[model samples]
Target: MSVKPGAADTSAAVTTASWLPLIVVVLTQIQASFAVNALTVSMAGITTDLDTPATSVGTAITAGTFAMAAFILLGAKIGARYGTRLVFQIAVAIHGLAMAAVALSQSPAMLFVAQAASGAVIALIAPALTVFIATNFSGDQQAKAIGYLAAAIPAAGVLALLIAGSFATTIGWRYSFALVVALAVVNLVLSFRVKPVPPQKDITIDWAGAAIAAVAVILLSFGFSGLNSWGVILATDAAPFSVIGVSPAAILIVLGTICAQGFFQWTRSRKAQNKPQLFNLDVLKTGAERATTICMATMMFVGTAANFLIPLYMQIIQGRSSLQTSFSIIPYTLSIFIASTVVARLYKTYSPRLIARAGFVVVAAGLILLAFTIRGDWHQIFVVIGLITLGLGQGAIVALVFNTLLTAAPKELAGDVGAWRGLVHNMSGSVGIAVASVFAVGILGTLVSSQLIDNPTIPASLKVESGINLDQVNFVPNDQLVVTLENTSATQAQIDEAIRINTEARLRALRTSLLVLAGLSLLAIIPAGRMPNEVPALEEPQPTKGKK
Candidate 1:
């Protein structure tokens, strides 16, 4: 009754041939994982070269995330029908070509188009990679493979930072995207070990459900993406349109929620009619799975926020290079890789809920520490200690939650699990980055306005004539702020006052953002507690006696 089509799930982990396919699947995952992190580190260079605001680059990133979250279910259908290996092969080729086009794009709009194209193809690559592993490995081997797959994310991110940093410094940021071309080549060559699963010809694809979900995800993502730019509550001048003076961002969010509910209702209706459903609702039927999903989303929310804010602060605000950002993150990234790999050993002893709660607690403590420590000093010993602590927690929770979700489902539902994983994780990451920007900028604007109004040294006339618009403030180095003030008819005294205020304001924004992120981390402990007290024990596969 399990929905595996065409290909047979391997027996006893295939001690010989399964190794190759496992490696291939992990490579496919790493290739897809490289996309966003590379873009994140290169954001400043892109914004500068394209002559656009910071929000423009942020929107492009969010648009790609939206495309991936919206189309991921349809991608699952494609993978299930056309087969994992072929879908992966073709998807990676398209993804690489699109990224190369992204490198060539001379404007923000063109970059958005290219990244969106790549996100659509990545949706296919996401689910197919999971399915490939399930079909080729089982038991102990499957468990080990899943750990590698989980670790591949941070591993890819680390590599992306290094490569993007190098390219960003010397050849130009455009050349950084060329790295994906290399990934595509390796993925294509190694993907042969993964067998194709036959399409379920009888299962009718649910186009209506897909449309509803797409509308829900895009609206929600776009709405969140503009929270800072378009205003959080009331409409700002950036509002494209508003209803009754309310922010379009809030309105779109409400509409998106309604559409999301509609998706669930329609899926239920399909099930009642005994028609095919787009996603396997059965995967979410258990309490453990639902809790795991919540924990996963929350982790990504904080994790992605950190990823975005750190690079924004280092490269844009501090005038550091992308290479500096990479080295700064090495402690965190390496800890993630190491912890994720090691936590699999502890699952049999410590309960899932226990380990997960511990991770969140550590993350919350670390964030709180950063809130107190970050005062224009990212490389301080205390700051590095906090980051390492957070990384250890992040690494463990991800591995624990991901493995829990995988084991909670039957092998036949691997594609469903993978698709759902992509949707929640990427969607949560987009939301995280958006929320971070919103809080940091919104707080900065308020703090800056109050401080400016109260300052004794800067006259109101001089402040007004400075041509500095806090409402549309972009992250720039203090030096750039001085350069930007060239248009102003302000005196040297007023300019020094402006620089001092902006500098203090920047640190305030960074610290407050960390406070909010810490709050979110503490709140996640609820779901972490809801995860299964312990994972069910499956018999570990015995090694074939004659196998090497």
Candidate 2:
């Protein structure tokens, strides 16, 4: 591979350096992971403390994720223009301050602001990690480093579940964010030891492309995340505004998709003009690269949807405590951690196409198993096995696709590749949770409305008298439902019937949603088959005139 003229030569230093830089990179990954996971594990406490609905927390998560996806392309360019090491240090410090804000948050709005700030900074850190690895490691060592970086996500999740769960249950949710602040500080202090590459003065930030990308991502993120609350196609009462009676969510999605096409067209124009592009389109020029992106997005969609559904089922439907929910998820998180760390060993023995195809198959089977085996009980052995199976597949694909992208791209384009990967992960994850919620709640609403009409116990007259709107139905615990009915003229028998209907509808909705995800997983096998038959060799750097 031809290296740009101004690119630093650190091959000799990289080969002789110790693993300290990798350690710093891994810690940085962990800090970001911990912030998100801690919020997830402490959902109950957050809702209670802030006196807000669960959807508010979901909004906060989406805001942060959307912010990251929106700005990551620009972030990659920023790292190249301003030294990656310096940018990384600043981002880490800012992230720590954001965590502190989260710890001190007095309301849901404060939490959202803090999390969004953290995510924007993470855009800088995410690309830098990949650049660091590409700059500091080579050959097998680089492969191993990517694997470790991938594993850190689930590993941090495990730690968050254990530590945050305990804190939320025993003390307060604020402690978890406090812990993240401390980790950020440690990462900052250790970052000074990492090798630094000189900034590329020739690279120019593409402000127009960045604006298009940011607007497109923001629209798509809000559109998907608001499907349930705002209405899939029609405007709901909860929708802040609408377009000619159509939901803003639907309109936003269409606009966002159009803007996305505009972004690509803009990039092409910039390339034609011989100007610095927002990202190197060549990073995704090949069929294999496109396929890898699809596979990565699909894996994240399935994993994140399952992750959202499981916790909702345990905590909301079953009324399990936060700590108990964390315990139930332990097997799944641990499986991911173990699989991510070890899957690198399989690259030499098996083709990536084969492994990726098998991984998707396993993921589909796991979802199907969970869909069928889930009962009122969350402690069933089959449930545990299903979770583990899903995690293993997700972990393997996560590491596999990332390593493939990095190895295939020239080192000069490493930051672009990383930015693309981060964009996929965040955008897909947000869409996954949104789609899952829409499916589960929409299905539940339909089933409940139909059951109310069919069940002899729930009279049509009662339904009319109760003033309940079928279209606006939401998933609530039985106890909460009972409390709601207490205000009405509902008799004991009517209330019991409503609870029974809710119980059955929730389970059926979950099963149907899982089946839908399983079908999506099976479809992903098409792209998985298109991945490189074997891992691609890293390109050796050769000097050339600087051309971004």
lDDT of 1 by residue, 436-490 (tens): 9887877888878888886888777766776667676656687887776667776
Mark the regions of model 1 whose C-alpha exceeds 4 Å error after superposition: 1-17, 39-63, 97-114, 168-179, 467-476, 480-496, 539-548
Model 2: lDDT of residue 237: 91
For candidate 2, lDDT tens digit of each residue in 6-108?
2443553223346888999999999999999899888989999989999899789877888899999999999999999999999999999999999999999
Q: Name the TM-score of candidate 2.
A: 0.91
lDDT of 1 at 463: 61
Ten-residue stretch with the least lDDT total in model 2: 1-10
